[model samples]
Target: MTNAPLILVVEDDVQISRVLQTSLEGAGYRVAWAATLGAAIGEARSRQPDLVLLDLGLPDGDGLSLIPQLREFSVAPIVVLSARGREEDKIRALDLGADDFVAKPFSIGEVQARIRAGLRRQRQATYAEPIFRFGNLRVDLEGRSLRRNDEEIHLTPTEFKLLLTLIEHRGKAMTQRFLLNAVWGPQSLDQAQYLRVYMAQLRRKIEADPARPRYLKTETGVGYRFVPED
Candidate 1:
């Protein structure tokens, strides 16, 4: 149906692609498949999928390279399914604008959940409501203020800007360099320590338990992700 979300599966393995297509279609998503990087790009351009499931290993070229190119034309959420589980590879993919990453030998249920979450986050970004809510926390974009259970919590201008940047890309793994450049400008791209300092400051104010944050989560070596809870 035209109303169903279109999912592009860019995978070279025939069996894997078939499994994904069947599973996704059963989950109410319309599926499109591409076995190579070139065909992937062509299908993406023609179909303009609502989301993409990319495999880093492709016959023609590395699928990681397709991320930036896809970003050029579409804001559709990209969930990378790859066997390369190295920390650096994940960091590179996220830095290149991937929405999420799942390793090979992945669960069908997990992949479906990731797709649902990615699609939900994409819709949120598209609509971009001025007010964001998760549990007791609230962020008012237009008002530029944060509140917890209706109690106004003050944040410094810089801290607010940092938080705002994270909120804008909710559910995505944002690299430190990306956050730094966005908030502090390109000149401060190397100042990752600033994020550490300010993030602590933010947690102190917003988090019920600063030691274990519910919203602003660290992605180990990657960066930060703003997780929204219903």
Candidate 2:
């Protein structure tokens, strides 16, 4: 009936698909399944399911290639099913507007938990205006402004996005590739320099000492993270 939520499952692995379908059905969901991006898009567009279970490895297309395209129609929470499982991949998916992800060979319990989290997020549209504070620096997203010890600061669009991305996952390391892809595009996956430039610019504006940034710290070969002072 209409009381049950519909879930669109996209996976190329037949057994995985079957297992997820069975588990999801067992958990009381109306299920729709697809094995490729084309079919996934068609079903997602037409069905407008309450949520999406998207597989990264499709025989017909790359899952990353389909995300932006899918965003055109469905605002349903997309939980990426990927084998990459790297921290970078997780950050990238999250930054690209995915609600969550489950790596390959995952436990059904974990997937169900993530699904619950994502759906919970989707339902809670009204959030308390978060005022992020790290030492002397503060950002009020609802107010759309930054402050340092009561002094307001200006931020460009790109700078704001970069700052927002870092702040969203404070203390978590995010790769240059992930940042570049999220803000720039998939074409920027190879352009680490862009990330370096933006990080430097952000530090200059937000940090007390850009040369020795405390909040926006880099992880040598990996990426950057925003660390809030306790």
Number of the top candidate by lDDT? 1
What TM-scores do the predictions have?
A: 0.96, 0.58
Whole-model lDDT values for every prediction: 0.90, 0.79
lDDT of each residue in 1-230, candidate 2, tens digit only: 46788989988888998999899989998889999889988998888898898888889977877777778887778888899878777666656656666778899998887677566545543343478677887789777689998888889888888888776655444667777877888998888888889889888888788999888887655677676642
Tens digit of per-residue lDDT, candidate 1, span 1-230: 77999999999899999999999989899999999999999999999999999999999999889999999999999999999989889888988989898988999999998899899888887789898888788889999999998689999999999988888888887888889888889999888899899999998997788899988899888888888762
Clashing pairs in 1: none
TM-score between model 1 and native? 0.96
What is the clash tally of candidate 2? 0
Off by over 4 Å in 2: 126-230
Question: Against the true structure, whose TM-score is highest?
Answer: 1
Q: After superposition, how far is residue 66 of candidate 1 from its true place, in Å?
A: 1.0
